[model samples]
Target: MEPDDMLQTVDSVSFDRLVLEDSGRMAVEFMSYGCGYCRTIEPIVQRVASMIAAEETVLRVNIAADPELAKRYEITGTPTFVMFLNGSEVGRTEGPAPTQSAVIDAITRPFMS
Candidate 1:
């Protein structure tokens, strides 16, 4: 399926339903509204999300908006991407600095491997 890169801003409940409930999806990005890095790469994340969002759920969580959710997910940083496949945690990209292409490469790497 061809996924759109439009960034989705989700709340805690919506995030749970979208990411935890879903399986075999490409990726989800956990971010914070107050993080400068998150803002910097918002466009990149959106592009990556659009590219592979067809059958996957690409959600952006604002850690600051929902601290409990961030803590539940053990997200201690901003602009972190937690990728899953078949309801399993495959891998994650942390500390930002990833470009749009790089974000796509990271999540799709598991498929390639």
Candidate 2:
């Protein structure tokens, strides 16, 4: 399918199935539908998510839709980007990175080691 379609929101059973069970590097975006920053960075996030390795899964979680999940992640605002490795958070970015390069820089920084 298309690159944009690769980024999906994981919630409840889906989150457990895709991220917890798989046990690998994962990228998750926590966002809200009404947030301006979330809307602005979506395209850049999508493109970066697509270009990443197949073994790495890109996920999005809507805070409004899933408040419990949001609380669990400690997401206090919109457009929070988190990188998971072996089912644990290894990196995170709060607020809009604005550019693709910044997003990539945040997401891949942990893996550089």
- CA RMSD of all predictions: 3.9, 2.2
Question: What C-alpha root-mean-square deviation, in Å, does candidate 1 show against the real structure?
Answer: 3.9
- What is the C-alpha lDDT profile of model 2 across 24-113, one tens digit per residue? 888788888799988898888888887885756678888888888888888888888788888777878788568989887767777667
What lDDT, from 0 to 1, does candidate 1 have? 0.71
Off by more than 4 A, model 2: 1-4
Ten-residue region with minimum lDDT total, candidate 1: 1-10
Please identify model 1 stretches exceeding 4 Å from their true place. Answer: 1-5
Whose TM-score is greatest here?
2
TM per candidate comes to: 0.79, 0.87
